[model samples]
Target: MGSATTHALAATSAALDAASGVDLDVATQLFTAARTLADSVQLRSALADGAAAPSARTAVINAVFAKEFAPSAVSLLNAAVEQRWSSDADLVAGIEELAVRAAVVADPSTDVEGELFWFSRIVADNPELELALGSRLGDASAKGTLVESLVDGKVSAATSLIISSIVRQPGERRVRAILTQALDIAARQRGRTVATVTTAHDLGASQIDRLRSALSARYRTDVSINVVIDAAVVGGLRVAIGDELIDASVSTRLADLRQRLAG
Candidate 1:
């Protein structure tokens, strides 16, 4: 993230934290507004141009979205436009992140992070599906319809909307990468970091709890674990928290041993 995007995100998060009565409705409005911005180059440029006066940007937001969005949603957009962004696309990403954050804040019971991770894994496991969703030749509306059919009843409305929005228009990013970014944003909204753990076998509840606790202690914040069972790991497990990887899997050890023997 560029400095401008970083600052904008911080400010938006603070606004979310301080707001009251934010719900899924607000998220839906934000998503719609984001889609509108993504589809219009002129509008995106108008709002994201750092050279434009902040007041002018705010006026544009009010003029375009005043009647379309709720007060809270419009207020959020107004705040977003006031900050400088690296690019128009970054502004779109910021809005997407805000939508996901709203979903997380609206309903504590829903597991948006887990839903996003599992969907990404599903795409990873199926080559045809990945190609279908990521192919530039495919129709955007068709891809969106596919997303809705697959996840509508299975996941929360918030999750479904977020997935649909990204797959329909993933600017310069793969579907899986976008899903992962959404997951990270969802985790951060709750003051937690996501730890993706891959093991050779499925872990039991107690084991998962213990691991979560251990990771939380290490990271000094709550950790959300998304477990993936992969037989290729052979044994043990691998843990990825952000860019840092803790590789204790048997396959990794064997690879290291082979390197030492060759030396």
Candidate 2:
């Protein structure tokens, strides 16, 4: 993230916070707008141009979206385009994040983070399914339909919408990675951080709770843990918290030992 994008995200997040009571369909509209911006390089560049007047950027937003989108959604888009984005990509990603955040706020009681995490796990475990979703040659609508069918009754409405949106327009990211990022975004929306723990086997409920508590204390904030079981881990655990990784797995140790012997 660039400096400009960091500032833009903060501004956009505040705008979404103010629009909490706005229609939930604002999320859908924003997602649509993101897809539009992504498909049009000229439009995206025009909107994110720092040299352009804020009013000029917003004028384009109004001319294109005001009539078609909900009033709240239009207002949010206008706010978004008014900010100085680092790049066209960041502008589009900021809009997408707002869409996800709005959906999360709309369904406050649902376990969206957990649902997304589990869905990512399912995708990670199934290479064929991941390839299908991540395949650029596949029809976007077909991918969206497939995601909707898989998550329909199993996930919250918010989770379903988020999954469908990301699946339909994956950009350059793989399916599972973006899903993991979405789950992290969902956790952040609730003022929590997610720590992914991969172990050779699943941990017990008490063990999970203790780990969560430990991390929460260390980070000075609420923490959520998503446990992934992988036999390839061989033994021990791998924990990922944000950009940091703590690897204590036997496999890593063996790799280090081998490197030392070779050296």
RMSD of 1: 1.4
Q: What is the C-alpha RMSD of each candidate to the true structure, in Å?
A: 1.4, 1.7
* Local lDDT at 170 for model 2: 93
Residue 139 lDDT, candidate 1, scale 0-100: 89
Q: Enumerate clash totals for all models, in the order shown.
A: 0, 0
Q: Which ranges in model 1 have alpha carbons more than 4 Å from their true place?
A: none
Candidate 2 Cα misplacement greater than 4 A, ranges: 254-263
lDDT value for model 1: 0.90
**What overall lDDT goes with each candidate model?**
0.90, 0.91
Residue 140 of candidate 2: its Cα lDDT? Answer: 86
What is the C-alpha lDDT profile of model 2 across 1-263, one tens digit per residue?
A: 99989998899889988884554587889989999999899999999999999999999999999999998898889889999998999999999998999899889999899999989988988999999999999998899899999987899888998999988889899998899888988899899999999999989999999999989999999998989888998999899999989899999999999999999
